[model samples]
Target: MHGPASSGWLLVALCAMTGTYCLTRMRGGGATEQRRAAGGEALMGFGMAAMAVPAAVFTPPSWAWSVYAALFTAAALPALWAARAGAHHLHHLVGAAAMVYMSVVMAGSPARAHGGGGSGVPLLTGALLLYFAGYVLLTGVRLVPVAAVAGRNGGGGSAGWGDRPELTRACRLSMGIAMVAMLLTL
Candidate 1:
């Protein structure tokens, strides 16, 4: 979060709120896959919020980066397994892997940890940026009223808050935007 304090705080708020909503989704009586997805989203949202905290406010210890990398690595395993059931889970896998990648990059570069924009591999960052940028666009298009209506009707009717596909897509879209912002900082 190498931007202004206001922008960093905004990122923190957006991510924390998304994480909270995902937690509630986990408690709702959605399908198994939906609940599972929510659980992973919750983890990702909260982790992003923590990482996005401005360095001026709190710089994590050197070892903490390793811990973040490890945690996300663990998260990715289930996402990889879940992808066997649905393609959407692959997005979760990529997100988790991206978190791990960022954590490692930050850990090795103290300058980046302090928001000085250290030497992360530009090529890798560009690749991730491209992926998440496409994701944000795709998710945004899916949020149109026509697409929402189709998704709802296809689901058989109104669903509980947690099972609402539109909300889930919106959540993912927000995360995708946040990811793009974060990568730009890198």
Candidate 2:
């Protein structure tokens, strides 16, 4: 990340925490799809944390960038398969692709080489920014208390911490915001 070390650390903390929470969610009893979704989110959170690490703290070897790109590209395949069952999986696919895109852009950038501003195609960056901004807004709206009241009133009673929809939405929203922040650095 091309920014103050403090901000980069903050992003790292947020993403790592989110990833840890998602790992717990995966272990909790839930539908297969839900567990699968949580698993994917966990992967994304950890990957983002790694990518968000301040270049000044640890500049990865040149080969590491290609590895990152390859990893996300491979991750996208499962997301693509899952997308056939649910629209949420489509979001996962996009997120994986975005990570791959960032890895590739960062690999060739002189700014990253010097621990300065990141370089990327302006148009693609703008498009990704717009998509993530919209996702953050939509996820934020979904997290409003009014939306939770109905679920609370349902006969299911209190959901387990890991299975709580609100928290899942909040987690997604946080990642969306993080994505926007990451893109801005680019």
Candidate 3:
């Protein structure tokens, strides 16, 4: 199996691919395309979380882990703010809050100073798992309506999954995954 560092890089690559796919789908501009694009963005967030997981889990050097935690935490803000536009659901809010909590714990973890698992690790991992589970569930459900609309006749209306609902959910899922991974690693 690939090492943690390599796995992190691979996840980064996955994020890039998904992000690109999102861009393409956005340009295409349709219900199916938009929903798929949103899914792609969510996939990117998952990739980000995947990249951070090993660093958090293995207890990398304080600075490296700190940077990883910081980046993930910072990314969540725009996501949370954007959710305000009504694109996201309650699950997104919960997931984002969990990530924020995880980030704070990770930022202050004593494990980094000692370079091994310590008192707070279990809480961190548990929190992350919960967050990830919620995220996945929310994303999976959010897609249902969009998929349903896509199957409808007459190309659907101008307002549909191709609009805010799908995009918001996609972003919610993506950010949620990253946050969950970060928490788990902590």
How many pairs of residues collide in each model? 0, 0, 0
Per-residue lDDT for 1-186 in model 1, tens only?
A: 356778898998999989988987898777787788899999999999999998878888899989999999999999999889887899999999999999999889956545677547889989999999999999899887634444443554434567666877888899999999888888
| Candidate 2 residue-wise lDDT, 7-50, digit = tens | 99999999998998898789777888888889999999999999
Looking at model 1, residue 66 earns an lDDT score of: 97
Q: Which ten residues in a row have the lowest lDDT in candidate 3?
A: 110-119
Runs off by more than 4 Å, candidate 1: 146-159
Which structure among the candidates has the greatest lDDT? 1
Indicate the worst ten consecutive residues by lDDT in candidate 2.
149-158
TM-score to native of every candidate shown: 0.90, 0.90, 0.46
lDDT score, candidate 3: 0.51
Q: Who is ahead in TM-score, 1 or 3?
A: 1
Ranking by lDDT: 1, 2, 3
RMSD of each: 3.5, 3.2, 7.1
Which pairs of residues have clashing backbones in candidate 1?
A: none
Displacement of residue 99 (Cα, Å) in model 3 is 4.7
Per-residue alpha-carbon lDDT of candidate 3 for residues 1-186, written as tens digits (9 for 90 to 100):
013566555555555554554554454456663454355455445535443544444544556545655555555555566566654433444444554454455457645423243425575567557757866787768766874335343564443334445655565555555445444444
